[model samples]
Target chain A: MHEQDTEGVKIGLEVHCQLTSLATKLFCSSPSDYRGKPPNTNICPVCIGTPGSLPVLNRKAVTHAAMIALALNFKIPERMLFFRKNYFYPDMAKNFQITQYDRAGGVPFATDGHITLDSGKRIRIGRMQLEEDPAKLSYDGTIESSTQTFVDYNRAGITLVEIVTDPDFESPREAREFLNKLSSILEHLSVSDLNLEGSVRCDANISMAGGRRVEVKNISSFKEVERALNFEITRQRSLTSKGIKVMQETRHWDEIRRITISLRLKEEEQDYRYFPEADLVPVTLTKQFVQDVKKGMPEMPEERAKRFQKDYHLSGETAQILVREKALADFFEEAAKHSKDARQLGSWLAVDLQAYLNEYGKSLEELKLTPKHFAEMANMVSSGEVSRGAAKTAFVEMLKTGRMPRSISEEKGLKVISDTGFVESLIDKIFSENPQAVQDALKDPKAVNFLLGQIMRATKGRVDPAVANRLVRERLAAAKGSK
Target chain B: MTKKQRQEQFISEKEVEHLAELAKLELSKKEFTKLRGELNEILGYFRLIDEVDTENVSPTYHVQDIVNVLRDDTPTPQQPDMLLEDAPQKKDRFIKAPKMI
Candidate 1:
């Protein structure tokens, strides 16, 4: 389907991903796993900005950010500095967020990179910086209507890496594709788990027809980014077509209403007095350290896709699908280790198993079917111990019950009946019952399918269709010879 | 110099008001004038550093000659109940604040 002509539309994205792989908060010894804990329970003095508490940087977060920088082809500076961005908000007890700045004698963690979308459009990454997340605030109602707000400092001081892209996306679809690709890269780096709720957030800036830029914030999910941009673009187009000027302002994406409401006017722009953060020292990335990080990098998505195609003899489409998700690709590799037919196993995973996953709206990690089970099912089909149809039934049962394929097949009587004596007797009974149909099959090749259908119905779809086909054809030819 | 000229030479009352707003400070008229005068005096002291003409010297972001003072990514035990004892207002386990719009 052709997308609507979004001519003259430009969108840029600022994605903030939490470095959830770290064991502790960015500047404190508080645990990073604070999703289910009570509010303010996982916080420390450094995170909550208690009086006289100093912040010490988490070394692993920097290395993880460096790995992401390398994966995206960013240039790491010799030294990176943190600045205190001064603002007054209840979410931050410190009243100033410790972050990296590219201006005012401060350098970001990395800069100058690009990620090419599947459509081959290169979205230039302007910069990637490290920052701390603010505490989460929950309202009794909506933000505008709520009278009281509860503060949860558990999420505060968590390490966040913000990736800013240049205004290179022409449409919402392209923006969504870029985010998916970025997520895949992050997954391969083992830096962050994107599946966690509120783990990744995006803010988008969009403009059309030389209008002033409008930023849409609070896009909490990957899918919502596209929806928010589409809504913003349509809203702007309506205004521009009516000869109205799009005002430059910040808007919030209301997930419930599916609209962008003006959060603040550009006139009330924040004056974040950024200055050097004295509590934390600068992190020096020497050439040796960068080289060490680069050396320790794992296989990225692109390389894994290429390897899948070459090593497993998989089609380009299948390889692309498998590698699009790191978990699915890992599952395929583990299954391939024990299967004799890697290509078959790859297609079963990329196509059939994926269909079931999509149908059930569950992720591969949530499934009970193991790689060993998948390999066993594929091997059974390869060796003709079970028909493809029977194996499919067994596969479904396995998914539902978390049972092994062999046991499921035995319980459901789905194994192929390959015994020649039993099959010969069934065929003889069918021939005696329908001699005229047998004679018709001897004359017409297409009539053989009718006989095969009969055999299938008689065997309750348990017979290997290939074995039954050969036997029925042989029996028909012998009868013709005798006549 | 006239009072207006002296005020212009240092910091203006309008600029002081803007800074106060940003810092979420509710300042009275007298306090604003006092802060403006005190801030100008502080700025006058800082202006002495402008005489240094080492144009080739890079800007110093930190006074200490240290880099990479980092801690390992390890979690220590936390006492939430003890920490909550300091809250002025609490709802369940949460820190409650005034109505925010």
Candidate 2:
């Protein structure tokens, strides 16, 4: 569909994408990838703003920020500036967040107007900026003194792409669809990884009747965003209906409770003290750079969707499910390369594999088995060596022991019996024993069909139905004339 | 264009205060009054956008650039213990604290 066809509702979104740089802090060269490491160990005198550790900007981080702005059709400043956004928080060892204020560290996002979507629907652009992320909060065990909070700077000081949208969304669902589209674009760009720890965070400002918009904070998931906005809208609407006003404040999404609770009052626009950064020079996207980035951009979601349909012959639903996570899509393609039937590959990944993952609340990437192993299983089922039902059992075994599909099938002896001679012998005994079926077989084709049903039932679902039917017909025809 | 449009486009100070309360923010009356005009102006701007023939416009939630950037199946570290060292309380490798005291 053309991007122009999608303008039915007033919706807007603010997207924050994290850049997982190898460097810890944007200004302080601590360490960026903080997985499974001691927290304070990852910190440094500079990151904590110790008196003499002067801050130096990570040039790579600045470039990443600029790249995102350019992709969004924002005007990049020739010079970049950094600002100390004053806020009190324990997560910030410095007690204040150093971020790119108004025009993000000289790479301020000066989005003049609208961004056109693949749907051809144009949503007005607000501003995009770069900022250093704050350390994440580690909640203690108990709410009331049961636990204490901790800070992990692993996420702190990493560069972030903050894109604000004009208030263009009218409903919760639109906001959801828009977020999905954004995640796809960021995935295609390789700039942000949503599945990472605390990588993408969302805040929604919802209002109606020109009433005050209460900004919902720290909604990390798209599902949570949908729920929070819906609840907040109802909360706001009821308040307004009952002569209550919608205050401009911040609220938290209690994901556990599925409710938005008040956190703090809304800050004034001046409260953020958004000023241009002074230290860095503004960056200008040369016509050359924009072209280069555009060239580097992989086929977008829509294009990839079409390609999956064309290349893999996947149903629209199957392709969409695989593409939801780039890793899953890669897994499907990699495994399909080894498989004989692409449809079986798709079904295994989209339906059967996902069913198991859901039971465990995991994803395919989290499994231990490789794509080669997965395809082997798919191949076995498609070749009719094992029933699709039996293939699931073999798959579990593969996951458990990393065994080959053939060996797992042998160990369980779940192979189907398709020999026509063996089945024809069984059919002869059955026809002589059931005199009633023989008499009816000569009387009516429909009654003869009932005897075939009995033969299949006798095999315990091990025999192939088509082979059994063919034998039953030949055996029954000869017996009728001989009698 | 009509009374509905004018009424729909305006934001009131009282409503701002209510929204602030829902957000759990303690706003000064002064800020509440000023936000009304600013809110309306912003609303007015949105109204201008609402008028644009967006019948074909697609809303972009994310600026497309990044695709799934994932780590290898290697397990990343969880939060470190030192972070919790300064916690108000601790109990057997977990955070412990007083009851709302």
Q: Every model's Cα RMSD, please?
A: 5.0, 11.9
Give me the runs in candidate 2 sitting further than 4 Å from their true place.
A1-12, A34-56, A66-107, A110-126, A136-156, A165-193, A207-212, A221-248, A256-258, A266-270, A295-304, A387-393, A396-403, A421-483, B1-101
DockQ per candidate, 2 decimals: 0.66, 0.05
Worst 10 residues of 1 chain A by lDDT: A261-270
Candidate 2: tens digits of C-alpha lDDT, residues A142-227: 44444456555556666677888888776776677677766766676677778886778888887777577677887887657877
Residue B12 miss distance in model 2 (angstroms): 24
Question: Which ranges in model 1 have alpha carbons more than 4 Å from their true place?
Answer: A1-3, A241-244, A264-267, A380-483, B1-8
* TM-score between candidate 1 and the true structure: 0.83
- Best candidate (score: TM-score): 1
lDDT tens digits, residues A1-483, model 1? 235769999999999999999999988889999999878889888887889999999999999999999989899999999999998777888989999999998999999989987667799999999999999998877777888878899999999999999999999999988887899899999999999999999999998877999999999999799888888888998898899999988899999999999974544457999999999899999999999999999999988988999999999889888988888889899999999988888888988888998888887778867899889888988888888777888888888888888888888888899898889999999989888888889889998888888888887778989779889989988988998
Please provide, for model 1 over B26-84, each residue's C-alpha lDDT reduced to its tens digit, 9 standing for 90 to 100: 99889987898889877766666788897999888899998999999999998777877
